[model samples]
Target chain A: MKPKRTGKPEAAAVDRDHALHLLRAMTRIRRLEEKCAELYSAMKIRGFLHLYDGQEAVAVGVMQALTPEDAVVATYREHAHALIRGVSAGSILAEMYGKQEGCSRGRGGSMHLFDQETRFYGGNAIVGGGLPIAVGLALADKMQGRVRVTCCFFGEGAVAEGEFHESLNLAVLWQVPVLFVCENNLYAMGTALEFEHAVTDIARKAACYDLPSTAVDGMDVLAVETAAARAVAAVRAGEGPQFLECRTYRFRAHSMYDAELYRSKDEVRQWKKRGPIATFTQKMKRRGRLADADVKAIEGEVAREIEGAVAFAEACTWEPVEDATRFVYSEGRMP
Target chain B: MIDGEQALRTITYREAVREALREALQKDERVFLMGEDVGRYGGCFAVSKGLLEAFGPERIRDTPLSESGFVGAGIGAALGGMRPIVEVMTVNFSLLCADQIINNAAVYLYMSGGQFNVPLVIRLATGGGRQLAAQHSRSLEGWYAHIPGIKILSPATVEDARGMLWTALQDPDPVLIFENSGLYNMEATLGADAGPVDIHQARVRRAGRDISIITYSASLYKALEAAETLAKEGIEAEVIDLRTLRPLDERTFLESVARTHRALIVDEGWRSGGISAEIASRIMEGAFYELDAPVARLCSQEAPMPYAKHMEDAVLPQAAGIVDLVRHMVNAHG
Candidate 1:
């Protein structure tokens, strides 16, 4: 089934400050991703670069529901999640540039970003690999009697993996506080949802594990935030695990190298029309909660941040060849 | 088997492992045991029997047959500051969760640039003495030792079975402990005060000068028995038990080879690309000049383990084979 087009945010409940915060977050991701594409073309940023172009609202909205103490496990396409989770743009860009100053100290590149302080487990590249880690994190919290939630972000494609089903069953059976967020972007790289899953509704599959689940309009930032807030609250209250299936789409190709033959340009154009940034911005304008000057100011601030990040990445130094085998085991503890 | 002054008691290898588990759980509140039938039903090998009633369900977790899920959970739990001892029923079953072990547990610290350390310990029953057939019986310690970042250990004696768990739990990286299925019921005397032992050295079980018989796990006993039979013929064979597989202690074995001028490796794993091959290669590299003869290896035949008793015996490395090989090597060189 085609994703239902999200309606406008409620005008009466719209707060100007909150609307701008969401818009700024989405804009920052868009500008950074656009810069990454340009860098790839110029041969500066190498390796697999997965851009989170149309799924900005999902990351921004879900992040709003999380606290500093809670943990996050994200997918390979997680530059936006890393940014919104407070990983500095300079470090992230430097990491993609393979510099020692990167968050993972150049060991992990674009597909494996990690930040210990922010509790960002990693930019796990394996499909369905992060699900069990997330479940275990929540299991640790529950066993220790700590009141913390672990939010895991993955694509709807992960639903087809055995780890997804295993993790869901384990979480519910153990009653751990995990918020499983499925970004059902209508495609698993190039395969659409219909071809990948017999039961197309991702939330329904989660509910089979007796997990509390809901589907939200992913393009509408406010709708996603509301649903995520409710889910995160239930999880924190020890009501067991919760699942949120965000009906979303991605406008760009799966990775840097793509023939674009698996999908048509018209399909991409249709999704771009309802892009997360554009739809959210227009809704705020129509509600009179945002002005054109505010939009331009946000754009200006995001542009400078992206430029500074690029400069930092360009000036960063590569890790020395002698220390290439470092971190294979913890320093000073190598066998 | 009793010491000069210290108190001593005899226990089965299974009980020794149980004592290790009990000691770890009692010492640290952060330590918990999770696996299939580890709690209420006891362990599949009955190694964790009575732990459920002693520690309660919270600490002795009985998980579903989701190996990848629970093993990955153990890694995450370790990342979250809990020491988890995950048990995969057998080496064969461990293949189900090999992705989690190889991809996540072994690579987390490096992939994350040392930002995360998985202090996780995984214990699985290995080797094939029982007629459980091909699917249930395997000796894959050699395959696991090939990977970096993780530590591979094969504890053959009651002392090692009781002591290795505590040391493995203290490691910052992942540690895999391989318990041979045949040794679970073997009984040996242990010092009442016996606690932790070093995990980085190879111990010489018996000393001699004619030849060096290097082995570990169940094969260590076979080597010892062969040494006894060779002593009657005046062919003194030194026995070396490789307690640790990875980061192998080449010094002890090299010194032995330097004195004896011959080396014989016995392993239950298949001959092709097995731990014996690795040890043989190491001997060539480190003790080539000291050796008077070519290094020899007696490993399991390159075939799946069979169900018939005689066929299985023929496929594995036995005491007769070790004696025959050692006698031939000593006589040819002498």
Candidate 2:
């Protein structure tokens, strides 16, 4: 499939305030993830922590086009998605701490954060697991005649799973309104796209299902937002499902335990030069939209927010062992 | 066949199950049935015939042969506030979608820390009698019963076949209904107005004082036949049909064993690590003191089901095997 570049930004779309806001959102994820890595080393936040280091633009940008009424299904490395979807950083951090006050009540450590109020379906750990759920959510909306979109986010690794093909076929067949956002970050864990897939054009796979698809520069927050807004509008207007392959990279290892044995350090350094946060900041400065003082102030504010979130997580009470067996089956709604 | 002046109606097990689906769709606007060939194809076993015209494609949805995808979609639909009844053609085919059934549907409620509960019902035909071979015929209800978060129901009777769907739809968590394929052609008289049945308890099909023959699904009929043959031999046998496999009604069989002072479990599933072993263990745990003889179990032979008819019949738990086991137990205890 051809990469859609019509919505590509040639100039600043917003003034100083909006750019800084987006910058802060991406930086919040960066800071929180950095703290998470530190905490992992300190033996505090235990469990598989898949950090969303370089791919912040994808989550922040795509989520901007969604409303609270819309549903979201995300992969395990979804700290940014949960945060952008209005889940409190304290709750996300508290979940990592395994505290009951956290989102998901501490049951889902890092990979399974869920919030019913925001319609965040999960932090699904299984590769390609969320695609069907997203399609089903869209089916519910279509059957109910609700004008809403279900945006599903997964790694490019999911394209190889049978559920991906099945879900795409079902979504298009039923005319369900879903925006399938595939984060094609060039690697599936340690396997590069070239090594993993015979054809690395992930968006092209949707053509077989007759769904409209496009490839976008995932590192540019503005381009991702433009593509996502267009896709979300198409889905909301009773059009069939749309697929967006966000071409990006994860600067960190797959999880906290990776040794970075696959790719060379030079390649990592080259990608780091075009990191989403840095590239966006540079673009804003070049356009005379954001000042250096604004950048420092944004950084300071985000640092404080991360500190408060860490403190909140540290102080939150642990779930009582006696209540461990609850919620297996719903206890039914109270009358 | 008319049972009385109360207006009896006879229906096959397949029809009863279909009736249950129709009633569920008619009663609840939120409930819908989706499966491979559940629509125009009228279900693989012809159980859902005419439902496509009645409910239309919107509700009587047909799906591709993607078990995991559709099953996961059913769970997602349930979470999205829709009650979906997903039919897998058979229990053997359900293995393809077991991940979604086990991990997502069963684990979502607990994994999400009570934020979500999948109110989904999955119905699949199970058991062996025809020469459908190994993959086509499997009694995996026992395997599903091993899970913690989901409920398992084996509808052995026509009433249960007609009644279990509505109750299963009303459940707040995932529920699996295993219909024995061998019993689909079996017919029974139903009242014109039959409704939902409670899914939590076991029913005593026949009462006797000598020994308790506990079983479920298609095996219930075998146990009842064994009870009859034992009656002619001057040994009365109480028969208990366990409708709910999980959260098993240990009280019913335990009380029956207390009265008869003997217990024999007949399950169509394999003997080792199967549902019979669980019931036997429960019997030993709860009713050991009251037993006049050691609890005996007659399960399917430990092997993959062969294709031949006689071999398949021999591999399953049958009436003759039940009679032989019960006779030995009664003779030894007496």
Candidate 3:
């Protein structure tokens, strides 16, 4: 077999086993998301389904760098991160289907996936909203004399928000242990980065706050993982927050109903060819790490997991409407 | 938990409110304060004075000028298992965090179908005084009181300020605590005599038969002053302070209107769609036939408060405004 072109030379020494684990993580997310897209189209799921079809590498790569204790806060596009964090694929799919056994107790549908045991805090829908939260979580951890990093994932369009700027400055000013991850899929809803920001180079925006940050080939899982690991380590060592701009593209529209008039078909097709799942699989196969059966086995397992989630959801019940106001306060109700 | 005789305490309103914040912090480890100047500066009105030293920085956090940041963070912290107390300098600064309060905190509980709870207590210095001007000197507690998911509270008396914080903190959902700036320095004695106040109930400061004056916060003082003057003229006025604004204590107001046969609402907020307006409309909607006369209201002029001391005072609902309105109602009766 012809040697695969290495777009990243430093990524060569990541070891085949770790590379294979990354491959498996991406495979699990990819197959799960594919099923989600189908279920959404088939009307098995009701509300908005912001599929992670094109953004798999960012979740698998970045999450792979963290210990389970560190907290994660992500926007509505959070399925990949939740799956990578070890929330069962069945549970996530069931949550999408609005099941009683769902992680959020069938209350938070797709945009809100929280697992207290896992420290995966959300599916926060408000743009640029999670930055402040991630800062506060890091603030709490820092005050507790505990060394932990909080990873906040947002979109490039979030840069246009004041919360993005305010939270970034506060995170650096307070020396909070937080990693600001920007999954720049070129567009925030319908607005493109170039059209929205005067300074489209998002990593440079972090420079204004004197925080160390970088831009990575978001298409490569190893690249995101390596950058995230170094960034997370620096944050935990009390060097303060680091920002990473994962320059990636989304293959599908932003939401279930977007006409996708924002970008050209060729651009999406070009990005899809560099899909993180297949790219990692091909690399691992060339290294004799991943068997064809291994890939099939992972896919088959993820599908079964998703199927179980659907069954769970189909068996679940809506929270009683009279109890709609139940969890507005914590001690007010029991989980 | 409230004993009746212990309610009439000689404590000043400021000390009472401080008591509330103190008791709330001590009662729950989850209760913490976050806002600009809440810690080191000890709050603009000094309500949080001595709190930073007493509670320490971890609990009494001094945040940046980022109202939206800290308020949103408070919402996050509430979701994260801590009962967060977020203080906005005023309702004006509160608008900065409105997206978090109104959009995220207020609606998340319902929108998530009761899956998420924002166990947050937001304290704000509201109402106009001391010549702060157009931007800083507006009362918008009514806007918050209108929201469904969260509870709104305005502590007009020392007892309410001191006692309301405990009840607000005890609540599982988000509670907005609005303290009138003008009332903080109004001294009252604090001792074992003063007891806990419930956040749900309304109290009548003065009992009368001629008419009822329902109000909250700074306007309650004006109403009481007016009631005292009305008593001198033999026009007995019943004054009810709507300590809790959201759940409203509407039954108290209805009972007052039902007995007194006429009602006057005095509010420091603007007249149009103000909280007082809501009370008056509810009376009109529910107990119209019981009225000896149409309900009346005295609210702030429908204009941004000016910077001059007299102008700002004139724009707000002062004791003079309440007294004059009551006199007019009496004269019309004659």
Top model number, DockQ: 1
Model 1 chain B lowest lDDT segment of ten: B1-10
Off by over 4 Å in 3: A1-20, A330-335, B1-12, B15-32, B49-60, B80-83, B108-116, B192-196, B284-286, B308-314, B327-334
Give the winner by DockQ: 2 or 3. Answer: 2
Label model 3 with its docking quality class.
Answer: acceptable
Give per-residue CA lDDT, model 1, range B298-328, as digits (tens).
9998889999999999999999999999888
For candidate 1, give the lDDT of residue B314. Answer: 91
Q: DockQ of each model against the real complex?
A: 0.71, 0.66, 0.37
Tens-digit per-residue lDDT, A129-248, candidate 3 = 888888877877766577878899999988989899889888887788999999999998988888899988888888778878888889888888878887888998889998888988
Q: Please give, for residues B205-224, the per-residue lDDT of candidate 2 as tens digits.
A: 99999999999999899889
**C-alpha RMSD by candidate, in order:** 2.2, 1.6, 4.7
Judging by lDDT, tell me the better candidate of 1 and 3: 1
- Candidate 2 chain B, run of 10 with poorest lDDT: B1-10
What is the fnat value (0 to 1) for candidate 2?
0.68
Task: Quote the positional error of residue B215 for candidate 3 in Å.
Answer: 0.7
